[model samples]
Target chain A: MSRIVLRNLVKSYPGGDRRATDEISLEVADGEFVVLVGPSGCGKTTLLRMVAGLETPDSGSVHIGDTDVTSLSARDRRVSMVFQSYAIFPHMKVRQNIGFGLMMRKVPRPEIDRRVADAAAMLDLSDYLDRFPSQLSGGQRQRVAVARAIVVDAGVLLMDEPLSNLDALLRLQFRAELKRIVHQIGTTTLYVTHDQAEAMSLGDRVAVMRDGRVAQIGGPLEVYDSPADRFVGSFLGAPPMNFFPALVSDGPALSVGALSIPAPSSLARFAGRTVLVGVRAEKLAVSTDAADGFLPATVEVVEPTGASVLLTVRLGDHELKVQAPPTFDTRPEASVWLRADPSTMRFYDPETSLALTV
Target chain B: MRRFALQVFCVAISLFMAAPIYLITLAAFSSRESLNEFPLPLVPTDPSTETLSGFLSSTGVIAGGVNSLMVGLNTVVLALLIGLPAGYAVARYAFRGRQPYQLFLLLTRALPIVVLSVPLARIFLTTGLYDTTYAVTLLHTALALPTTVLITAAVFVAVSPEQEEAAQIFGASPVQAFVRIVMPQALPGIAAAAVFTFVMSWNEVLGAAILTLNQRTLPAQVLSTLSFSPLAYRFAGGFALVVPALLFIAIMRKYLLNMWGTTLK
Candidate 1:
């Protein structure tokens, strides 16, 4: 029943040129998992630390379950965190690490043991409870950190790049386990990471941050399908969105070097002004044979990426990426044709870099 | 060739360090008649306790031993009490003058102990602590603090601040987190500092001789009297001084070894 609400949070580090987190406000519904994803120094981690009471904002009010806890220290707040390095005490065995929060809370001995045993079983660490962190593998250590965080019954759980230290295969495997465990515990969470795939897979909703401000916040598929800005579109997907510089001509069509795209009515007012046309790499179709309305491109590189093939092609003077079936046979420097559905195209203002209304 | 050369170098260094202690022990325990023989045997051939027993039975030896042990142990405790916090602060915080403060600590040792001894003795004399073990203990603590602060600061820096933040977020107060998490991890460093302090205090003769007369510690007492004693008795005193430092290091070796295994995977 604990929901987190932040109001107008602004923070700046000493000697930093600009604010680390600008005037930003956000809310996470009860039991919701929200992830903050951005490039380095985008203020996503700073925003999460503010909520966790680890970093105090220059100006903000934090509310947990309707309680204004802006002045409370981290120990007084009902929050738990899993650090990037795990931060497990090397001297403490697994059981002690899991039970540390409970012990600090003055929970009874019997209850602490019961909860620790349950958490151990949940994390599949029962057999390793007596072993120290030095004896555990990286994945096991990460699981121990998760177990320690969840055993506290905190109102909110904060994590900062917790899975970024693991290997790729472990990260993929642990991603599902983490989402499932968080849902089962029903604790509100605010996770921060630079990895887009982790943000998409683990969060119920992703908040895309840029320059200390949230560029967009929406469901995973919603943000992926329609990004709010050029930055958001390019940041969220693999291969990113390929942008082509164009001009808005009559009929609100985009006029590039040799092609005219019929844009939506939103571009009608800027009919004579310049704009950028953005399309996802996966949205452009590749054809080996020539067809009408398909622009010819020179295949510069063919990358077979397990499930699909990504081809970098040169159309006119611009290079673009197109997704094709993995089995699609192709060779370097070969000629190919490409096309895209008009609805899949997004138009952006070049100056502001914001997505134009569609 | 390199491996063999390295092993030879290591053995050479070990023998260079161990030879003096072995020689003193042999000289201390040998019979008075046997010690008179020229080109003394490198090995223990005539083991006896005549000179050692005579030195032990001499006046004020046991009392000086007791005073030395008190001063050494007290120096270890006081130095750590004052130094550990300064170490943690220097490691964790970045307040103004931090770099200057560390430099200042190093500079304190740059002044020779002899120059500071007169002013230090005058201060103690004015405070009516001239002839007490407390004066020696205070002097030893001041001498030991720079090394203690630098070493423990390095250890605290190696200990992750994230662990302390995690503890605070988990419901422990700042003090409690330091006690439960930081202190245990800092033990090996503290032990190393203690070993250094104890040995320095135990062997320091100039300050102890100037500070105390009738209440002199073993080293100061030995220095005041050993020039007039026989050579065997001097060897006996050397044997006695070396044994305690060796024992203290032995007791602390466990924690010193714990330093390498302190990190999480």
Candidate 2:
């Protein structure tokens, strides 16, 4: 099936309190592109390394295409890795870099040339094939790295933050190109990145990681709209999700200090108990009228970003970021009402931080 | 203003290093009669090849020079053959005792040559390699190895470990990855180490003197008789010794400066 299965993996560095990767298990179906996204040191890269056989787990097994590959070395496992630094064999020309794997596998000379040419053509690197990495631009060098990875047609491709090294504009451009190529080629890929936005746009399914464990694994929007915990909600959004504590009251409402609002019915059983409320900036709409579920807030700052205006609003003692349409003219210190849909807001147990399913 | 001052500082440093070499060359070429004058003329006065020719034609001079060249070249080969892999191990692997092992390699350099030479000479005498280039070659290799290993290891460390990992991921075995990925990129460092080893072996006198008698290297030949020889002959010997080392550096200057290629792209 060419599927990748990582079973109960655990790895720890010397003298570290927490494992780099806890008993983590994951699967990547054939032709699927799964991204492991997290904050730095969350073990996403380590887990990907374990799958590629660059790292051996303390206890676990890796299986690829129905064969146990835990004991196999990376060379024998037939997986290609694109390193974050591009690692483009700086000494070699672009043509040789793309053909290196086939050469090592003892492919015939003409066949290596043909495959390298094909890869170069696919990556739009035909003109630069004779140039060394030093002669190419940063974005072009990364294309060579990707070309090198895909030329071998390895069943699985492991990329460790391949786009993180590029500048913002180049990164955005490469992101779309990479997704188009990966989907067209249908190679199973396990990509690791600290940037959550890249994870959202590229992966068929995204696995959010925290403290060496998978926090949540689902389709990007599914995880974004309904996070498994406070960490995932705060991590995946731009400007991030706003978090504040609220008390569930028997009035079938939530109370944050003096302000009271209707609560999602799922929290009715937990009345008088504290819950952490999470809301994305885009989810909170600014209402002109005192409509249902509208809370009084004072606009603290207005930041116009062309397409939308980002407003920092103070509701009681809490500061919440609200994304408003650019046409909405609101200045600092202006009193306004912000409305949030009860179903769109996520609630978690205050101490445990686990989401309360509604 | 700052750039001009920095340029003057750099020029001053270069001149300070080059002055002795200039004086040595002038003294070696001048006739003995001109050298006898107080505060001798500094600008190639009475230019002659008499003293240098005399030194070159002395007993065992040509053979000793040839022997020094062979020993220097052999030492370069032997040290690199043994040291490169040891250096690669230190650079790539994180096994137990890795730090201590590198420190231990450096510590071996602290042992005095006087202490090592006697036992080494005795062993060579028993092994029938005494008074031969091989005995001197082996001794020089020992002296050159620590520098070779440490410098190459530093260079290997500069090479992104990701490149080697990328090679292995692409299908090269560990050894193959080092050959195909690490070695090509490590050439400039290897060249630098070679330059240092060649210069050290060509100039080293104490070990060569103690270890070999009839079959002496150029440095040992100069040391044995230069005390009784005239001042002009001594200058000639110094000039001769400096030329080859200078030539080796000049030949290797290109690789030494082109080291930034190994860094990540």
Clashing pairs in 1: none
Quote the positional error of residue A271 for candidate 1 in Å.
1.1
Query: Whole-model Cα lDDT per candidate?
Result: 0.89, 0.90
Provide the lowest-lDDT 10-residue window in model 2 chain B. B256-265
| DockQ of each candidate, alpha-carbon based | 0.86, 0.85
Give the top-scoring candidate (TM-score). Answer: 1
Give a tens-digit lDDT track for model 1, residues A1-358. Answer: 5999999999999878999999889999999999999999999999988887889989978999989988899999899999999999998999999999999999999999999999989889999999999999999999999999999999999999999999999999999999999999999999999999999998899999999999999999989888898899999989988887788888877676777656677778988988878888989988899886577889999999999999999977788899998888889999998887878888888888888886
- Report the C-alpha displacement of residue A125, candidate 2, in angstroms: 1.0
Give model 1's TM-score versus the native structure: 0.95
User: What tier of docking accuracy does candidate 2 attain?
Assistant: high
Task: Score candidate 1 by lDDT.
Answer: 0.89
Off by over 4 Å in 2: B1-19, B30-53, B94-112, B115-132, B230-232, B257-265
